[model samples]
Target: MGFHSFESPYDWSRIDTYRRRAEQCPGGLVDLSVGSPVDPVPRSVKEALAAAADDGQARGYPKTAGDDSLRQAATDWFRRRRGVDLDALGADLVPTVGSKEAVALMASLLHLGPGDRVVQPKVSYPTYAIGTQLAGAQVTTVDDPANTDSWVDLPGVRAVWINSPGNPSGQVIDRAGLSKIVRAARSIGATVLSDECYAMLDWSGTTQVGQNVSIPASPCILEPGVCGGDASGVLCLYSMSKQSNMAGYRAALVAGDARLVKAMTAYRKQVGLIVPGPVQRAMRAALEDGEAVMAQREIYSRRLRALVQALTAYGYDAVMPQGGLYIWAQARSGDCWADMADLARMGILASPGEFYGDSHRLRFSSTISDDQLELALERLHTGA
Candidate 1:
């Protein structure tokens, strides 16, 4: 299950060329390539972490399955925010150091191996393929995540990874769409892993693809309307990074099938993959602080709105994403590298569509400061 030498699925050298070009501009580079949070971590979360650190009870090794309070908080958050009703005893929830690890290790954690097939959207985070490869599984892609006919027939299907408010694409999947995938996966006994990390940043009415639901954000895979309230083989991964500005904390959790949660928790314990006590407390604080989350959402809304208008006028044919922090703009002939070259000349660094398995677009993150965004706008309005 291990390779003798490390190989990065992403080609950093390719992007570095554009970064160098952007750096050469007189005004300096306005990097919009990454999704890292640039805002301050919420005060309540920091206070909770500090309190936990000093408490004698929290100084010891934390539970791999997560503390009772943290688990309850996660379950409650799902109910109030995502319309997911988890088990009473919290058997359906397990905290991870971050959602990324959970995502990268999911195929293996589910005991998938040689000959097993894992399906994901064509335009998706690269980690999905990495995780599948690590587990000795085959990877397949469907152009549309909601199209059940596209993936239901793949041989030896074991897992399905769906990200809404998708990375790079910034497209949100509606409830009806999510339900179709759940139904298809169930018929084939495939486990579905739903990444709803950006679910809280729903920029409704400007969606490029799916319609925004009545929920506070995007439709969740575990919602009753989606899975019929039976989370038998489904899991939803949520991160506190973007919404709570807790990226540094590396706090995230997965909620789903009780059996599956128990299995993954056991595997994690055996591997000593546990969230630190203080971080666990911090995550619980984030889950309860809805006001702080909403404030952060509004901040992103303004930033994303500003970028969409700027890119549109710059002739990128940009559409405001329904959710997530990215602005997915059109590129000539779906030539991502060419788009990168064009943007680089303007002293703007962005992610090429090739990075996300796309043909004709580029992604710009809105996580930079307002001043940096204004700088980008200035550069866009004029040439480098």
Candidate 2:
């Protein structure tokens, strides 16, 4: 097998090993390398799941395309949160195992092959590129989707990915900026897949607290006017994992372009890729309750403020995150591992920027507890 090694570029096992080493330290570790929310699920959702589990009907084979209630809930969510009346999405709506798996499988279903190009962000979640490779498509990294010049000349580019509230960088593309990319891609007949998984966590209010500046959250490809009434060549992927602390539930959905989603649904039905019945019920509860989502946001917001201020005070150049759980920071001394090693010595673990894309940067997560965060502040002060 002349298999190309997409797995080699990312070493999750190596990353885990480093985290384990830090965990073994006497003081215990504040593991911020992974962005898994260490928060409790809303009681409403938990109860909903429990109720669904006991309904007896859930024992039957789950609806592979998603249940009617789940699809309707997704539609209602789009109208309330996204400012779009998307009735066409109901039949097209299919609950995913999770957004990551949805993205990975999307390329294969789209029929991308060896010569096709899958354009993605220069610094991205890595899954986008890996998915493209799985379908034998080439990965083209576009540093800025807002800039038309960055993608105007790429050849054979079948699909372009835009991630708002980016994973490692925490950058968000504004409406006008996103409009430009959608126009450019549409002109060349390329599909745009916008990953707005972290759109719910906007931290724009705390930028001026210190030397760092926070950017505001903005939706790019989903802008109704930019997408031209019909979402023919556009799609938006979102997950309840971050917003609702339902990462283990594997609940997520892709909305947009009825035709595209319908094709995806057809392929998915054959493959048995569906969110379990109980998880779908849980997602419905999670989506309908706005208060619970905001409460979770507050938890992350408070932690972000403390960590951003602490990193700046410690002489590390912490680039205040615009949105999302990560703060992209650079070493004042310009050595990435030196900074990581320094933090690790104090039992604070962070993901190196090299894992995302470029070297010489590091990412800190705001998903830790308040108590652990305070301890991290102390470690930062003492470690440096």
Candidate 3:
């Protein structure tokens, strides 16, 4: 009931202060702050959106639970892209505006409040904490899931967030590691919600897609291999923003735990949180085209290599991102914002580590255009 009681993890003040300075910069700022993709949406997706918009029936109110065709596409995409067993997931598939909203609202839908707690990574996307706070729940930050010590003593914890190829760290949780956490969560009768928005971007050399790979670099929490066989209290939140460049379309889905999905769908329907007709069309088109997603992945791979090498040359040791469009790096000396300021002065602006609950590290995104990426590399080399 109290508005000011909710605490946000992000440094809203600092971000606003930085925004002002970035606006005045010479070549306009080379923003690598948020992981928003800047690439153009695929033509297939665009064409679909336009066609849906021009349809006479599209003018009416869209279905809150998503159209049958969109749901089927979501079903197919998970089966083909993530290797999730549709039968195992059961009736637990529902559409959302995007993964961000789904991730944040899941806490509330579960009725987590006051005494309840949510466990999340120490270095995590800020929304995890914000979501818990908004639900009137406590947040516990764990550095690694393999540490059983961190799992005990949190009796009131109802959910544990697992972000593979994590947002800020780009660390992939393998099958063995995932099994440990899933077991721990299940033991406590808690749910394991995996934010796998970046699961399609694994880059550990062996391709998770195409012809050669056996196991994926990033394992899904609901994967039979990772869960040792059940998706009991699990859910995977995914978005088309990253892989398909559909950020503006707000296309995403929640899959797993049929009961949970039903509850969420009811709540969402009551609140009118539905994807637009045209956006749903675009999502279906995007999911149907695996080639476009692969092409996008290759582009990110090249940019990631360039950024990692350049950051190393700039005297920063960057963690090799196993997947995702980010490179986590640490400056040899001083705080990360100081490092960010240095980069900004050199004409390249990187997200300060502080944003992701990390003080000593910085994140570089590989979502820029080729020319901008080359310029960023050049600036890094000259320390401009």
Candidate 4:
């Protein structure tokens, strides 16, 4: 009952205040506070959704575990893109409405409550803490999540949430770093749940395996070296929102650890947390079309470069993200709210770091349209 008393993690008051100020600016606002995609969904995915919708048989209640085709597509995607072999672990995968729901429901689904401690990144998506709270579990923040020593011996730690290409910061953890965390969590008898929603949008070309083999992709927790080629005690949460522009469809899934997936799937079935049939079909189509994913990635990359250049020219220290849809920036003033207000004065809106558990940085999203990005850049350069 105490968890039920907790307030929502999002503070809409800040957004409302900024929205009102932005409305009064001379030019129309170029909103970049959130990372929601502005581009249209791929034709292949949309066609699949339409076909599924036209199928009268798809109107029936869908399976909570997802269709066999979806599961197969997800597994094939992991093998082809993430360099992870999940062929034998097909039964461990289950589609969720979206990665956010899986994130908010993981602790409860795992039955962690009353004195159980969940380890999370110090600066992370707030939903992780909210989910732990919802399960009556305590949260422990590790500032350097990639450092295994930071969490190896934490008392009462039951679950660890790893977010590579992190939300607010866009920081990525390499395979070696992920392996360290996995080993540490295993030693402590804690489960690891990795959020990999932005894996496909990697901007860094430093994904080297061993000495000579380089793969230009974000490191996955389920990578062979990261988890010793075994997915036991680990789960990965992925979404088709960023890569496929399917955020509205709410298509995502959790894969790894057969027992845990079975537990969550059983609970989700009872509660009706199923992804719709049409969305699942769309997801399968999206997973199969690698070319579409690459095309979307290139769009974000261009937007990211333009935004970073504009922010840099405006006297802000904007760092290029290795992956993910945000550029973590800091102003010389050392005040996030002050930087946010300045951007608002320029008719450009960005998220303050306070919302993401940090106070000196701001998050600028690169998911805006090309025209809007150009407008934002023009405003920054012209001081309009």
lDDT of each: 0.84, 0.78, 0.79, 0.85
Q: What tens-digit string does per-residue lDDT give for candidate 3 at 54-126?
A: 6642898788778888888887776666666756646468889998898877788888889988999989888
Q: Taking the tens digit of each residue's C-alpha lDDT, what string does model 1 give over 1-384?
A: 342122333676779999999999877889999999999998999899989987753768889988998988987787777766676323388899888998888988898888999999998988888888888888888888689898898789988999988997888888889899999999999999999999888776422222222336788888776887688889999999889988888999988898999989998998899999899999999999988998898899899888888887777888888789999877854688888898888889998877788757788999999899999988776644
Q: Which candidate, 3 or 4, has the higher TM-score?
A: 4
lDDT of 4 by residue, 63-163 (tens): 89988889889888887788777754433899999989899889989888988899999888889988998988988888977777777777888999999
Q: Tell me which of candidates 1 and 2 scores higher on lDDT.
A: 1
lDDT of 2 by residue, 1-384 (tens): 122446524666656656666776666898777898889999999999999996643888788778888888987776667655676422246789999998887777788878989888888887888888888889888788777787778889899888888888888777777778788888999988899888778665421111121222345355466565667788889899999999999999988788888888887787788788989899999988888888888788878878888888888777668889998888655766666776776677888777888668888898887778888888777663
Which model is ahead, 2 or 4, in terms of TM-score? 4
State each candidate's clash count. 2, 1, 1, 0
Best by lDDT: 4
Candidate 4 lDDT (Cα, 0 to 1)? 0.85
Which pairs of residues clash in candidate 2, taking residues 3 or more apart in a chain or in different chains? 215-322
**Candidate order by decreasing lDDT:** 4, 1, 3, 2
Clashes of 1: 2
| Candidate 4 residue runs with Cα over 4 Å from true position | 1-3, 7-9, 89-91, 208-215
Using lDDT as the measure, name the better of candidate 1 and candidate 4. Answer: 4
Which stretches of candidate 2 lie above 4 Å from their native place?
Answer: 1-5, 16-21, 24-26, 88-91, 205-217
